[model samples]
Target: MNDELSLPATELVRRTLAHAKRLLPAALFHHSVRTYLYGRLLGEQRGLRPGRDYDDELLFLGCVLHDCGLSAEGDGDQRFELDGADLAVRFLEGEGVASDRAQVVWDAIALHMDREIAERKRPEIALVALGAGFDLGGGPERLPPGYTDRVHRVLPRLHAAAVLHDSIVRQALENPRKAPPFTMQGELVRQATGGSWPTWEHLARSAGWNDYEGYRP
Candidate 1:
């Protein structure tokens, strides 16, 4: 990793995933981590570079910490974003980032899932929110009327997002333990899926186990 860009984002994401591993269902952990990474990759693709006004280190840290609240409970409430944002505000403030920049991170978290908020915020935060929305597959239906036209102007970014999403899904399948069993094999199929059995088969296939036929779910 380049020292100038600093690998803080990756490191922070790794640490956050590790921490979630100990507490969350494998599927949920994988989903959340992938979602965060998707946001980061999408942001980069969009040319929405993090400005010097905020430390890249802090931005990465904020991105990694952005979804921690989801681990606290299992619900689709947008409040999860707010909880994560509040946590980031405190964490970044302690890390010596200015209040204004910290607020940028907080606002990003708060509005990540809400396009209406994106329309009303600073460009920096709006960029982050755009990435988050894209990660959730928020098509033009979720955006305001003219937003899609504006976003279409950035073709490369959209292409990058599609590629990144595919990569993340492949990685998740390769490591079944990282994803919820149900996600890998729907709830109806979990019983037929076989706990560690499916995981082993997945690992084997990933490890080139073409002839190793075993129970598959």
Candidate 2:
């Protein structure tokens, strides 16, 4: 317990998870915990010290609540990311957390889906995205030895990626406005509904794709 990064059992964390579990599908709740575990591993690999380069509490809050926008309470006119960020921020504020710390969590959750921007931000923000990206893309071979096993043992794989992807597609299908053109959500909807082939997936697997004409790295 001393060496490992354990999820705090504070009342706040407990209540937050309770609320998330109530709204999010079982697959999503497991996804959130896995995201936090990945973030913890990333923090260690980067030599981040507790209470300095990163705050474990904020990291947990950001990673666990990152996908909360998909929850019913998180739905709004804006994208799920923004809606979730706003919800997390308000929740933190209600708990009397300082505005600055609350803002870091907001940034992490809101930018988790945007790797390019999130990477250039604070460690808290970058780790959130890195964690989610790693988990969604499947466990990387280079992750710390036994780290993946440790996380998986505590939070077993629930095939959340497929569940989440379907949820996003369903949301977009229900409200075309939910998925704007060219965005990830829009692309998912397009592919799911057979509007177009999955060229994006093809390009992702292409060899030396950056060298292709009109391709930007």
Best model per lDDT: 2
Residue pairs that clash (backbone atoms under 3 angstroms), model 1: 27-179, 27-180
What is the C-alpha lDDT profile of model 2 across 1-217, one tens digit per residue?
2346478667878877777778788788888878887777776778876577877788888988888888888887667788889998888899888999999999999899898999899888888998888888864437767877777776767888899998787767777777876889888888887786446646665765655567567
In the order shown, what is each candidate's alpha-carbon RMSD?
Answer: 15.5, 7.2
TM-score of each: 0.44, 0.82
lDDT of 1 by residue, 102-216 (tens): 8877877667656676647755565556555554565442334554343333221334344433433433344433334434223323443344435655766788758476656
Best by TM-score: 2
Q: Any runs in candidate 2 off by more than 4 Å, and if so which? A: 1-5, 139-141, 196-217
lDDT of 1: 0.50
Which residue pairs collide, candidate 2? none
Where is the poorest 10-residue window by lDDT in model 1? Answer: 184-193
